[model samples]
Target: MLVTAEGAVRIWTINLPKAGNAITGADFIAAFEAAVDAANRDTGVCAVVLTGAGKIFSAGGNVREMADRKGMFGLPAIEQRYAYVDGIQRIPRALARLEVPLIAAVNGPAIGAGCDLAMMCDIRVASERATFAESFVTLGLVPGDGGTWFLQRAIGYERAAELTFTGKTLDAATARNWGLVSRVVPHEELMPTALELAGQIAENPPRALRMAKRLLQESRTGALESTLGMAAAMQPLAHHDDEHDRRIAKWRSA
Candidate 1:
């Protein structure tokens, strides 16, 4: 299932089980962008949750695909291969632009691109069995996509470097300690907890929530003054909405 919906959260499950549920080619990116667009267009959807169906979260790219002799031998084949890799890598940035909040429900192992995908989300709730690693270097590749950017921001530059350089595996507890995942719950409780969290977010005013997400995302590359201006500019628009008025009236009456 590339995308599934439950209540207010649209779940995107990585579906390439042929390679141990790995995301291989351009099709994965196309599917993801479509899912984000669908979720964004739905008035009922207030958030998105990304997870892996079945057992493994994802095993990054298909190792066999990357090691194809045809692709390595010719310029055209190499270019085609690169295009495919590029599309796969762009999934994180496409996900980053989604209007609503994204929560990663890390049910199991997330290595390489799988790990990067989880980190790209605004929040991550991991199962006890979940594990993360930056195993790209072990495969003789650097962290592609937004992994370096997100990881550095997530766990600081030094730690990100260590993880990238050493290709070390991090368990749920260690990941939580380094601020990779926001919370860790028992395996059975993972989906419920993530859904509950998504439901809570859904209860908020949708426009305001999306605007807040935009501001936070923009803040990453936005200038400080511009961010401040944006926040200041957005307040009146959000505060004057009917949802705000009703919620405030309820609070005032209380």
Candidate 2:
């Protein structure tokens, strides 16, 4: 994993493209945890963009490891369950805890667990070469990582169900049509577009951006009244922030 910052936007690139960028056991989890930790520690970082090196975004779980019955996949049924809960599942959980907005720049195939990874991001921007699939069924396994939960929420239950059951892949255009990705661009333009969007998000007051993201996340599972109460409570905090006052003063002078 390689993490670099472009101003207030952090870019995290998964660098194992030779293996189709497959995520092996604890490596991915540790890298992601570190990246999130770094972002949290850096007050200047307001947004993040995640992408892959080389041609493929990610192939998801390590298929070779699964086929050889090695690593996490080789454990006993109960042990396997625990491994997923304690290991691979950490990626989504870590991402969920992030206050800054995240954007996925899908440069190529994002299959199986890879698809779930993109779904965890707050926004997805795909290259025209990008393809997505909830391919667990093809390998005779279920979505061990949070694909089931994220996929349905991304493209709706019906569409997610069909893809999961069939293990079919969708092109960038189809994914955009299904609301899985917000924008599709040429392969070379993927990161630039994602960074441009991230820049826009990073321009906002950091505290307000984090609070707004928290409110949106809460609304996903919380009741409407509960979300409204949170918004009401958070609004005053934003109003009192120095960044808010500075921006207001600048706007009034203009």
Candidate 3:
């Protein structure tokens, strides 16, 4: 795992290209969550850009571990369920608690859990070479890592169901057509495009940016009055922020 900063956008590269960038085990989960926590602690960060170092963004779970029955794919259905809870499942939980927005830069193949990881982000951008698949069915398994919940929300229920059921692969253009990704760029332009978008988001007042994201999440499942109530509470805090004053002054001068 490697993390770098470009302005207020923190870029996270899943560095295990040799292993196809598979999010292999509990150690990887702990490192990933720890990185997320670090980003949350930094108020200066307004967005995070997650991508992979090599051709594959992530191959998802470790198939080797599954074959060996050693890691998260441990034997016994009950232990396997608990293993998911104590392992890969913690990632989505940590992401849900993230203070800033997350942007997925799908550099290449994002299969199975990798696709679900992208769906967890606030926004998604794709490289022309990017591919996506909800492939748990191919392995005779299910999306135990919140894929069912997040994938449906990203696209629609029908589209998500089709992908999950058949384990179909979607190209970047098709992904955009299905509203799975915001846009697709040349593979070489992927990071630049994602960073430009992140820069636009990162320039806003830090506190307000986070609060606005919270309101967006609230509006997803909450009532209209509930979203409004959160906005009402957040507005006062935004008004008191130094960035608010500076922005106002800058606008006045302009």
Per-residue CA lDDT of candidate 1, range 131-211, in tens? 999999998987766689888888899999999999999999999999999999999999889999999999998889989
The parts of candidate 3 lying over 4 Å away from their true place are: none
- 1-254: candidate 3 lDDT, tens digit per residue: 89999988899999888877887567778889998999989998999999998899999998887888776566688987788898889999999888898999999999999999999999999999999999999999999899999999999999999999999999999999999999999988999999999999998888898888888887888999988888898999999999999999999999
Task: Give me the displacement of residue 36 in model 3, in angstroms.
Answer: 1.1
What are the C-alpha RMSDs, in order, of all predicted structures? 2.2, 0.9, 1.1
Top-scoring candidate (TM-score): 2
What's the TM-score of every candidate structure? 0.92, 0.98, 0.97
Model 2 stretches with alpha carbons more than 4 Å out: none
Please list all clashing residue pairs in model 2, or write none if there are none. Answer: none
Which 10-residue window of candidate 3 scores lowest in summed lDDT? 66-75
Count of residue pairs whose backbone atoms collide, per candidate: 0, 0, 0
Candidate 3 — which pairs collide?
none
**Candidate 1: stretches off by over 4 Å:** 70-86
- Model 1 TM-score on a 0 to 1 scale: 0.92
lDDT, candidate 2, 1-254, per-residue tens: 99998999999999998788886558767988999988888888999999999989999988888889998788999988898899989998898889899999999999998999999999999999999999998889899888899989888999999999999999999999999999999988988899999999999989999999999899888999999999999999999999999999999999
Error of 2 at 152 (Å): 1.2
The lDDT ranking, best first, is 2, 3, 1
Reference-based lDDT, residue 154, model 1? 82
